[model samples]
Target chain A: MKISEIGEFGFIDEIKDNTLFNPDPVVIGIGDDGALYKTTQGMEQIAVIDTMVENSHFIIGRTGEWYDVGYKAVASNLSDIAAMGGIPTHIVLSTAFRPDMDVDDVIALYKGIKDICRTYKVNILGGDTVTSQEGAVITVAAFGEIEAGKALLRSGAQAGDVVAVSHTIGNSGAGLDVMLHGADGYDELKKAHRFPEPQIALGRLLVKHHCHSLNDISDGLASEANEIAKASGVRLVLQYEDLPISEELQRWAAASGTQAGKFVFTGGEDYELVFTMSSADFAQLQAEFPAVTTIGTVEAGPAEVVLCQGGKRELLPAAGWTHF
Target chain B: MKISEIGEFGFIDEIKDNTLFNPDPVVIGIGDDGALYKTTQGMEQIAVIDTMVENSHFIIGRTGEWYDVGYKAVASNLSDIAAMGGIPTHIVLSTAFRPDMDVDDVIALYKGIKDICRTYKVNILGGDTVTSQEGAVITVAAFGEIEAGKALLRSGAQAGDVVAVSHTIGNSGAGLDVMLHGADGYDELKKAHRFPEPQIALGRLLVKHHCHSLNDISDGLASEANEIAKASGVRLVLQYEDLPISEELQRWAAASGTQAGKFVFTGGEDYELVFTMSSADFAQLQAEFPAVTTIGTVEAGPAEVVLCQGGKRELLPAAGWTHF
Candidate 1:
């Protein structure tokens, strides 16, 4: 039938009826503001989004490593699902490029994606590729499933929970400084900045042991701690002396005369997990990995984050990452 | 312990162990390239992606209506899920804009998204918003579920199956012509161009009834027919006289001295569904909507699409849409 004969609404109804399922998974279908779905039994879903733009997110020429761009873009999203203590199954990617974008960069980018997908054994399924006016824009959406009622949240922290981080915090930050300043020889820090790994496995361990709360440190530690504090409605007191700083990061900071401690507190894009758990859970985790630090403690107080040592008290700078 | 003290690999190890889910929905965790997930029983996942760019995809000023841009962006993705005979559940959007983008325009753009999400009952789970160097880039990743055994692939057509379309064609192409020419009074065609609804219901019904191969008419019918023919390893013989063309499209074409038939066949972005089913299924679908025309048939010929009526036969135009 011609859609025009029945008008727009009639045409829409035809479209709607064509999608009806027998033993449907639909809780609600067309004619609403959103589609409703029946959830799978025994599973909760975890999702993550990552965005990459030309010039702003990554350089296209000279300093741009197109392969790493693709690798890290996918990693960033996967990390979020990992942060939530969930397993990822499917990923969708969207790429927008100007008409003039080199074909080689596109191939390299897809290679990076394929490499990661093969490693994770996740399917690409489908995605969008369109023409942009100028530079390229890439966004990846990653999805995973987890045990229902068990996916970790940032609001699960309690007073007396040991504030712990999965790994040292300042390497990525230091790496970024090295890159921006065009310095040399901190190859470890540079790699950390370009290809920081997300703590997916560590996240699952925390969930398995009934850890109180979990978060990925995509932003700096200070901002991440603030998020956990606000979400859980508690205060956090971290030890500056206990802040995780890599040897390479400390060396780079000393050579550059940059404050290594502040870098741990303020840098961004680390893609690590900053979490809290009971000392017992922490101890169990420590048995497996002795370097997991009990850096602070959750406390019953206003929703704020502070750092101190040597019998002094001070507020940590709100070192939130703001991308432009 | 500080991540730096343990080094990069050690930090990654800690991250990996932490995400390891006990009773893991995580079939695979960190150290892999992508995360692996276990599936929900009896269901298959369907995903779709839509990308909108500045200048090329939509005009940012003058003729541009930000609200419609937002609405159409979301609708386009939903339409793809519908095309696959799946029930859409979650949608994630990633938008890149410049620092100078007006706050009100952003509000209006989101309102457009809000309007459609409200209509569809879709929750905007979460997405990434980042700054761009130039114009706005919005990409949506939409997810849906279908009965695993029942997903309708593009390779299911068979000889003698009757070909059918869910609605009339050509209106959207005509609408675009009108908009580009700045002509007035063809609001229906214009609306068809600006806000074509996705055919979710029709897709579901097709799957439930066990139809053969199916395809959405995003490109012109000619290209879609070619896709089906190529995928299914069969040939399509369409009756040119039987093509569904709306009155508005006809009027616009007549006024412009454009062949309405060519518009129905060669112009793209119609967002209709074209499929082949048994005569029995066609009869069943037709009983509800008499306008469902048997415009063509499938046959054992070279894998190509031909248009014929009475004594005339010609190869269909290769006019599919292409993106860079």
Candidate 2:
């Protein structure tokens, strides 16, 4: 059967079931966005490899500058590290380039990657390259380190915990939609789509604050909330009206007759942090991070995310952007 | 300006020069088959990622069983770890598959990979999969560890060292040739092409014995020998007559009117270890490893490799299979 028929989510399930690495050192593997292993030095090693295929996850020029592609590539992996509240140290870039690609473009791509690496103080230790028959396939494998027992996980939320997001959501999806239609004048949205900033600082702060459960919004807020809920065996009740939709996304949603809440729930590639913690911790986090918005609370119930508003409660569709 | 115009060698040179890694932990990076780094635990971390594109380094059905492609993918990365004389601990497989591919085939491929991982006791920690635009692109990024200051490098050959290979050469190239042409026989050659075994035990043994410089014959004997000579700043005079050619390749070469020596020199995908060490060390290795074949000697001179036979000498062309 074709992969499109099987669907990316089903395939991910197959991979999770048959995952081959369940060694003693592996603290968590295959289920989350990244894998975690305890190193010999008593530190938790966080590893994540994200594959970005041309015309799929990214486009050569449709999204942004050549440098943006490179910047985003590293940024995505760093975001995975951020999900685990780790600091990236090493990366290996395995890229398959089209044979006829210009040498300068590849260099520019590398420069974009290097620029970000320079900013993050991570080293591009090594990588291998292959020639693709057509489009480029760039995969970045990033390695990070965190203090033992300090790395946050999805399976740690508790009942009565306050659910919050690191910042405003839906800009990336809005930006991408605008760009695809060639709509004018939303540079911030386009920038957000082109380069979804990795919330490294926020991740570190969350770890320090001892947040209960956390995951990055790579897919969508709803999907991430569901993940944390399912893994932690709790119910997440999201207040639909409380979602932190940006003014830009709000204006665009209004013009398009689309609910900003739905976009915030279903839009992907946001790269924000969705976390749950104690009310005190959430208060402290909101004070420290002015952009954070508490949009929900955890409850003792079935493992799912429910949207509550205006005396009506409904289970979310578990819908999100899957690669398939 | 196209990659084909720049050529793989030129592009590699550009990458080596513009490499973004030069940290205190990096012992060797970029230019070698794998990068070596000193970890905080004082162990040397060896990392290498190799990309195998469809119809380029491998074929879906032409190679052999569905498992051969997967087996060879992991083996290639293992070969790089072998080159460094390190013990592989973990691997991440990033594969791009055609959407029309069968789910069963993917499972079979994973089974093949799992078989090898089980044998080597290496963990398949994690990987990402993508939809291929055309054919499958399978890449393996391997990580290994060796005691600090014990890893071998292409730059460790001494002036008076004796050059040798771990086993017979040219079988993989000849096997691929036989497979490409419609031939039924030459099972050994076909096996060489399909499931090239990584010399893990041999590599570990060599490291224990303190082999000076080592490389794997992924791009033919001549190219690997040249790498050692160039990196070590020594002249390598390979006695063509002493080159180890399997009886199968020799017979095929004789029937096809191809020089067995040249086949040994230019044939690639032969996952054998090529090393240079002191003459005394070479003799000891030959005795311990009965199959070890000494084929050349390193001398103080210009950094180059020359093929010599019966007092006649000529510069060997620095040619091998490059993607471009």
lDDT values of the candidates? Answer: 0.72, 0.75
- Which docking class does model 2 fall in? incorrect
TM-score, one value per model: 0.85, 0.86
lDDT of 1 by residue, A133-195 (tens): 777788998777678677777888999999998888878778877877778678887787677
Best by lDDT: 2
Off-target runs (Cα >4 Å) in candidate 2 are A1-40, A320-324, B1-40, B320-324
Q: Total backbone clashes of model 1?
A: 56
- Best prediction by TM-score: 2
Pairs with backbone N, CA or C atoms under 3 Å apart (clashes), candidate 2: none
**Tens digits of per-residue lDDT for model 1, B53-118:** 877766754234888788888887777777768766556677776766765666667777767766
